[model samples]
Target: MGNEHLIGYARVSTQGQNLEQQRERMLALGCTRIFEEKISGAKRDRPELLRLLDHLREGDVVAVIRLDRLARSTSDLLQIAELLRAKGAGLRSEAEPWADTTSPAGRLILTVFAGIADFERSLISERTSSGRSAAKARGVKFGPKPVLTPSQIAHASVLVNWSRTLN
Candidate 1:
């Protein structure tokens, strides 16, 4: 698109890591603006990433050095891609050309990836449910520890009854 912007996002996992290389690469790739942050890809709350997402506009392309720099997992990548698609923006990875969302073939690949991620999630949910059911059958107790023991509860009941009798 004529009015589209090539916005860049560069991130590192820690304060000690340098963002200069990613910044320079993105700039060389013709990025109009770049958002840089030092945060782990595994972290859910990344301020600069959030800001970049919020900064996206229709026809904008988020250029990143690599897919791993953008997300830690496939599901996370899909979620971010979905957000970009919803916002009418695109995603491009310099390292992984197949990851570009602006092309038809790339979109198809992403669609297949999304389906696989969905199936994986479903399998995980089913396994968890089965495991929980089996654990319950085996008398495994789940959830928080009770605040009061049976004896404490009985004592409180007796005290309440005594107060009621007094009334």
Candidate 2:
């Protein structure tokens, strides 16, 4: 393989967040092509991310400012890493400094981190579900309130029912 090109991926969750710092860092690292996204990591589908993945080829190196920038959840990160591995590509994180899946030690560290991320996600889900259940027991309503007031909704319902009967 020829000299591998450093492919940088940068993301920010909000418009207010600056991509300049990330761009500067990636440029400093000799990244010729950088993919940037301004979307929440919670979102599973991101256009730029997909594009970057598609553009990656064997012997390419995917660089990110941080693991969190690549993926918010552990499983997602692992999945991305696996994709890179399958493509004969590798992952590097600037912030972590030690996260380089190209090396044995980096792989070990990533595994440990993936486990921790999974645990954290599980705990968050459990807590959210418990909180919702507790609120329900107290007769708290979930989701959006009726768009119209109760009286207006009842009127609308009656009108619809009457119209259906007429039909």
Candidate 3:
């Protein structure tokens, strides 16, 4: 209702997805500027996202195509929302109109959903840890195979010695 600028943020987790749909939606919503990222949702250190956050001003609105586009985890979502609140900015998710942070009801709903997401993450972590422990007890190996074999190590040592002589 005020003279606030509407900004849009769109992201795709993989290379196969396109940002055209999100761009069109944000444009239809009268967004003046849009920031887009092509990265995994699990990655927290996205450059474009950080740039958009830094560019936000008081009374500005940040719109995203979906909640997952903004954050992959509850903690991340809460952190981003808190930052927006502190900056006097609002968040609007196109996928869930109830996620508009400008309204009291939307704030309450987002908080409840954040709690649920946190609980789900905890449960998943517990299950994963339990499974890993059981697998270890059964003598199963985890993680990627060692890249350097004994022969390769010896060859690397020889190379290192040769390089040291040149130095």
Give the number of the best model, judged by TM-score: 1
| lDDT by residue (tens digit), candidate 1, 84-148 | 99999999999999998999989999999999999999999999999999999999999999999
lDDT of 2 by residue, 1-167 (tens): 13778999999999999999999999988888999999999998999999999999888889888999998767888889989989999899988867898778988988898888789889999999999999999999989977899899899999999999998
lDDT tens readout by residue for model 3, 66-114: 9899988767888899899998999998888898998899899888978
lDDT, candidates in the order shown = 0.94, 0.90, 0.91
How displaced is residue 86 in candidate 2, in Å?
1.0
Error of 3 at 31 (Å): 0.7
Angstrom error of the Cα, residue 88, model 1: value is 0.6
The residue pairs that clash in candidate 1, if any, are none
Candidate 3 has what TM-score?
A: 0.67
In model 1, what is the error at residue 73, expressed in angstroms?
1.5
Model 1 lDDT-worst window of ten: 1-10
Error of 1 at 12 (Å): 1.1
Provide backbone clash counts, one per model.
Answer: 0, 0, 0
How close is every model to the real structure, measured as TM-score?
A: 0.92, 0.66, 0.67
Misplaced by over 4 Å in model 1 are: 1-4
Identify the candidate with maximal lDDT: 1
Summing lDDT over every window of 10 consecutive residues in candidate 3, give the lowest-scoring window. Answer: 1-10
Candidate 2's C-alpha runs over 4 A off are 112-167
